[model samples]
Target: MSGRWWLLPGTLCTAEVFEPLLGALAVSPQQCRSVRLDRPAVEDYAAELASVEDEDIVLGFSLGAILAAHHLDRMRALAAVLIAANPFADTPEKSAARLEQLARISVEGPGAVMAAAWPALVGPDARENPAVGNRIVAMAEQTVQDLPAQTELALRRPGAEPMLASARSRALFITGREDPAAPPDRAMRAAAIGRHELVLVDGAGHFLPLEAPRACAEAIRAFLLGRGQDRS
Candidate 1:
């Protein structure tokens, strides 16, 4: 039987952000679907995902990962992948940083906020590639309008460490080696709590799905296939 996969995009992102990765995975036998979160809160997104009836593999990127971590207990997925997300315990510094970014967005507007965040979101190679860079920027521009509300929701999101530690489903954490927003070191620590495997794509940045779609697809494919074999 073919496997089922559900993808969740990051904060302020539509399912469009996963297009490249989804296209890369098209040849796989697994059926892939991307969940578009219209609401901003982690709980809201989690609730939507939890409502899905089918047993599938869930892959969440950034904010989506946070949501997945928050609702893992309620989800009926076979396995979960948290991509470019910080699912560890919250810290005062992290909260402060988010607030600072929120303040910046409030003052400078969404476009400015996106421009400021672009460096951390895309890798140098992506920026150098005209097509990739333009596409990433366009995606950011399209999504920026939702930044303020999304930022607020992110700040209010509950820490996922407790959920991560006790989650019944197998978990995988994937991050870019060069991702400053969710560094590999931090991702590794977060994955360690759940004994989850961590996969770092060498040349990618925060937007691993777009910047390194092939690598991301390969890692996810291997993980899901291996888990499927174990189950059988």
Candidate 2:
């Protein structure tokens, strides 16, 4: 019943972000693998995914979830998809504003963006755990510069809402109740089409896979197993 699994990271996030999830899932019967997509346009990202066929599941987080939706076509042979902490919207206005804000971040510098985004992405423990906080901040500061241009390009590209709506693959949307970036409503709306499943974590923040790794992994395992049962 189990097969290969792919874990795609969030925007500006490397495979390291999914370490906890991957480690926990490693014991599963399925083969666990991770993919790192560079800062690229949605279509281009989708193109890359076109080559990733035959996997049982593709678990995409944050911006990676959006790409998963955009590239759902590339995963026709897969079992299902788990999109985490994504700002799922079909409107152009939201996309436009997002692109614009990203552009500003690109111009103003990642420090400014990180200063604003860090608080929203992580919980207060981020401040308390100076080591973790400092590491993520450093990574964000380095990657935020490319984010604006990358996001703007993605915004201009066609959204995958329609694609996801049509795809037969079961979609599971996971969100943290405390996450300000990707609210529950947003996740719910994004998964309105197809067989959509939603799971909310009470105390977790946007970085649920990092902050509440065990809970996040448990939810994903349950969702995947449930979806498999439905297919059976």
Candidate 3:
């Protein structure tokens, strides 16, 4: 059956980040809940999900996606849409690098993540797009308070493999072809471990929901409508 949506944003992301995707989805605000990542632990930040009801759908981007998959069994939701999902454990190198990033961004201010990872965050072709560049920068600026705690969460995060394998069969995974953070190949391989489905958005990068909101919405619509009687 079709279900209401609960949208969760990624690290350094605010609820406003999903505005474009929400508009594209064409659902009324009353039928959807926009959640934030305030806590520092995966399970802790996910406390906002307590209100989820039967047949509901949890849709999350990046870190939010990983959280939804990892916590699926604990909720009564019918399915999950994990956009830009990378449910694996952080490599030691990734953790160390995140540490360096924390130190750097702490000194450089909130917008520093965009400066440090802009090339990787946006597709090469999109890097020159003034609109995309400006919007993401604004998003980063808006997310100043959540930066440090989210980075620390990324460091303390354990692999979501076990949970994904056990509870995420109903998950639909999507990522951008150009997303270095969740590359298509890696995302496909990761999803396969849990036997979940994945869709790739060509020419887009890590922020597909922002960079290609319509495309993201179309893919999501098809996925949901294709689920027999569930066309939310």
Off by over 4 Å in 2: 27-35, 80-83, 87-112, 124-127, 141-145, 227-232
> What does candidate 1 score on TM?
0.83
Pick by lDDT: which candidate is best?
Answer: 3
Ranked by lDDT, the better of candidates 1 and 2 is 1
On TM-score, the candidate that comes out on top is 3
When superposed on Cα atoms, how far off is each prediction in RMSD?
4.0, 4.2, 3.3
Query: What are the runs in model 3 whose C-alpha is more than 4 Å off?
Result: 112-116, 227-232
Count of backbone clashes for each model? 0, 0, 0
Query: Which is the better candidate, 2 or 3, if ranked by lDDT?
Result: 3
Report model 2's TM-score to 2 decimal places. Answer: 0.78
Instruction: List the candidates ranked by TM-score, beginning with the highest.
Output: 3, 1, 2
Q: For model 1, how does the per-residue alpha-carbon lDDT over 1-232 read when each residue is reduced to its tens digit? A: 1446777777657666677887887834246677655566676665567655445778789877877878776777778878898876557787787778767766876556765567666788886666665565566567766666666667777778778788877788888988988888888878877677778888789988888989877877888777422110
The residue pairs in collision within model 3 are none
